[model samples]
Target: MTTVQATFDSVDPATGEVVGTHPIAGPEEVQAAVDRARPAADWWASLGFAGRAERLGRWKAALTRRAHELADVVHAETGKPHADAMLEIILAIDHTAWAAKHARKVLGPHRRSPGLLMANHAATVEYQPLGVVGVIGPWNYPVFTPMGSIAYALAAGNAVVFKPSEYTPAVGRWLADSFAEVVPEQPVFQVVTGLGATGAALCASGVAKIAFTGSPGTGKKIMAACAETLTPVLIEAGGKDALLVDADADIDAAADAAVWGGFSNAGQTCVGVERVYVHERVYDEFVAKVVEKAREVKPGTQIGPITMPAQLDIIRRHIDDAVARGGKALTGGTVGARFVEPTVLVDVPEDAAAVREETFGPTLTVAKVRDMDEAIAKANDTTYGLGGTVFSKSRGMELARRLRSGMVAVNSVISFAGVPSLPFGGSGDSGFGRIHGPEGLREFGRPKAIARQRFRAPLVLTTFARTAKVDERVEKLIKLLHGR
Candidate 1:
């Protein structure tokens, strides 16, 4: 008897519509994909900066032309509004263009100044592609987030084998297929469909590096699996991101940012505002404005359904825990089958699970802090620090500087993700390593430093045939020239 591989369906979380069926790639199949990519990686890397940029330019144009069509797929698979889906696609396109236009300057060879002792030698360093990059993408913001790594890796001249989340395989397929229409010669960019096993296979398939975006627990598992081969991995994990509203902050703007940041995508964003730290003088006003905005944005309208049903249970548990621990629900307090109403809680303790944990749902805990210092303290008191926002008229930058997070938006939320020049990632459990901007270009490549002698030095310190007289003369010269 022969064994048959398993298959899974991508269903719409809101209406339970079967969007597409994807094969569960087993280890052998996963390894096969990586094997096919090895030669393609070399071929792609052979395309120097100018050649790769031209190919990437065509791919970017393809993505830009078919962006709306792709956004429809994203909306169908992830249940986000078509407009929001387009927003993500647009950002991905911008990043793709940025990488293509700037790759040469960021990763191309550059002269390095040699030290005084090595002035006779010339030094140059350039970033080289890491061959094959395995990207295990998250379901939420599926296209935008993964494309950050995917575009940069490709622009840096590496083949990519992507494993999208099981929930949104169709979107992943759409991306790869779109790219193929532009560059059809090789499997430079391919998608492997499956669950956790397929992802693990990619990690152990000897890919040069793995870029994973998901929960920290799964990140740890990926790290452990990659340990066997010592494969490098970049983990963009969970974030309990916080929003701070100082006394001088524009309360309306803060409330708007909090509402959109926390409730958009049904609160499935890793950088969503899960907690609000407001100065005592403005805490009451902030809560009132947030409640007003929360009521205005209804699920399935301004917000969307929870893409991952399992996350609904986590949201429920967090709300239940918060309410039972002396917290009051200002607007929403209940959960539904698919959509979670925008919920706001007050009088919640800092120790409450809702505040301390990553409730990847549309929920916010509002707390009163004596001053901006206390607000900063409360915001930094978390295991994950992916993204943060500060809404203050006078002290926005000052407070933003003190936050322990990789990316922060002053007077805004999640704007850092749009700027193609800014790097994105986080410290701690939010995960290390960066994507986007120059850092992203370097992330997928290794520096190749070259040193060559311009002319033979009179001293010949590196020569094996140094005489005692030469050594004594060098020592005397060094002491006389540099001795204190």
Candidate 2:
């Protein structure tokens, strides 16, 4: 007798329609995937940076050519607008290309200064692949967010076993299938579908590194599980990111950014602007403009449904709690079964859940501050430090520096994520380990340092045969070079 595999449905949040069915992968299946990855990683790494890049280029080309097809999968699974899905796919494609093209320059062997004391030695450092990498992706921005890790890991010469969020497994499968179309030799990239248990299995699969994107609570759990095996992990957890408006900021631009940053993607973005601090001088004007812009954003048209069904209750609770605590809604404040209207709340207490917690919905809590000092203080008060925005002509960079997030956009919103060269991650409760750019390419690899003796040292200090005279001369040389 044969046993049937357990399966689950991926539902479209907007219409509750069954998008696809996927098998639930257990620990055994997850381990098998990692086991297969070991040899594939060796082959992929042996290809050298140039050879691997050639194949990665083909993979990216395949992704770009059929981007619309992938976008449809993203939209169907996540309930995001078709255009938004396409935008995510486009960004992912660009990052994949960037990683493949720049991997050699970023991770290839490079010379290091031998220093005065080691002048006779040649020193060098290079990054080597950590074998197999496990990527646990989030549902929101499924394509773009996970690619931050997936592309960089593959480009760095590591095989990957990706476990896409249960809600968006099809998108993950689509990506792996597309990759197979280009590089079908050895399962360089593959996907396993399931719920939390599958993710835990991946974490404990003994992969070289695990890159995860999810909630802080879940991030802690992932960390704990990975710790059991001493597996290194990269986490891009959710954030309560903020947008600050200075007294001299462009009110119109700030408002537009606030609306888009806070409401776009139904505010399911980990770096989405959930809070705003406006200077008292322009608080009313800024709120008014934000309200005007937000009103034009219609739910089910401009914004999509909350991808996760449970998020609707959280959105409702945040709104109700704010109103109960004397806050006022400037515009939209209602939550439907599947969608939530853009809600702007003012006068909410700083300690309220809406202010302190990650709402993860299309809602914004706008507060007035006396000056930029207060704005900075309030913005940095949260435990989550992922991303933020500052709108000021003169103080853009200065204020951005003060915010406690990993990446900040000045005079814009979420711009850092679009730039391929910027590293993205967070600190404190938002989690750590970057995943984009040079830092990201290195995150999936280990550094190998080499020091070769070019010739015998005249004053041999490292040998037991060194004489006192040589030691004294070395001390004098050190003092001559660094004592000042």
Candidate 3:
């Protein structure tokens, strides 16, 4: 008897055309990939920061040179506009470059003060790789989002096993193939194409760590699986993020940002602006400008099809529920066979599903608030705390600080994600553990602390030879140093 491999086809959401077919990786294959990554991780770590940086630079160059080719794959799989795919690829390249160049400075061994108690000892700290890291990516923003973990992990001297979202496996494979072109000697970055079963296999494969980006429910499942082996995990779950427009905000700019932030990627973005809270003073003017701009956004050209087919039903249900509850649609309110037009709802109750849930589609719910205080309160009321935006020239920072989210953009929309130096993640239901920047580099590694005695102190405290007189002297020293 011969074994038959099970496979699945990825289809274009807009036309329902088959994009590509990939084999489903079972637990055995997933484990095998992890096994291969172990030795590769050791060798990669042995190369030191400088050596790894040199190789990563080549990989970055490969991504940059053939960016258009990868963008084509992204566009075909996710139905996102070609330009949107390219933008994500560009940001991923930038992050790769930053991680490669700054790994040494961020993770290399550095000196530390020994403190008064251990004055004669030389202390130092450094971050070391944890061998193999597993990355489970999302279909939305697949390239840019997962690279937050993959690039940083590789830079910190660890091998990676990536399991791309089933909807966008081709994009994931493209990334791994590009990387292999530069570093073929080892499986430094490998991809396993499959569904949730494959991701579950990775979590249980005993990799040093797992970085996951998906729904909070799925994130919880991943965390539970990793907990079985005491393996650490990082999760970047979806969010019900909001955009706030203060009374003094630039109405035209805020409207532009709101429309773009809510409708881009067919509103499948994890950090997309799903809700808008505007000051009552300018609510009418802002809503008018938003309606004008939103009407200009053409489907299939400006907004793409909803990548996941199941999301269409959710989008329709939310619109129907909001309307049944007396909310009015100022622009659009219907879902098509493959696409959802930009839908803007007003007068929806705060407890409505459209307001409280993560309707990952091209929709926005705008509400009026008396002042910034109410705006902040209403914005922070959601269970998800991922990313937020404030359009206040004078109170941007003040309002940003009060929003209960991991990242906030003042006077802009989702600008923090574009900057490679900023750490990205969320709290509460949005999930925990960061990826990107110094924190991201450190997230993939474990810290090692070292201390060496340079000279013996007269009042030794670690041995059994200490006398009563020494104890009294130590007490006096502690009092002198900390009594104040």
**Highest lDDT scorer:** 3
TM for every model, in the order presented, reads 0.98, 0.99, 0.99
**Each candidate: RMSD to true structure?**
1.3, 0.9, 0.8
What is the full ranking by TM-score, best candidate first? 3, 2, 1
lDDT per residue for candidate 2 within 1-484, as digits (tens), equals: 9988899999999999998999999999999999999999999999999999999999888888898989899989988899999998999989999999999899999999999889999999999999999999999999999999999999999999999999999999999998998898999999999999999999999999999999989999999999999999899888999999998999999999999999999999999999999999999999989999999998888889999988889999999999999999989899999999999999999999999999999999999999999999999999999999999989999999999999999999999999999999999899999999999999988999999999998888877998889989988988998899
lDDT of 3 by residue, 453-472 (tens): 99998889998988999999
Clashes of each: 0, 0, 0
| Candidate 2 residue-wise lDDT at 399 | 97
Q: In angstroms, give how far residue 368 of model 2 lies from its true place.
A: 1.1
* Residue pairs with clashing backbones, model 2: none
lDDT of 3 at 174: 92
C-alpha lDDT score of every prediction, in listed order:
0.92, 0.94, 0.95
RMSD of 1: 1.3
Residue 191's C-alpha lDDT in candidate 2?
97
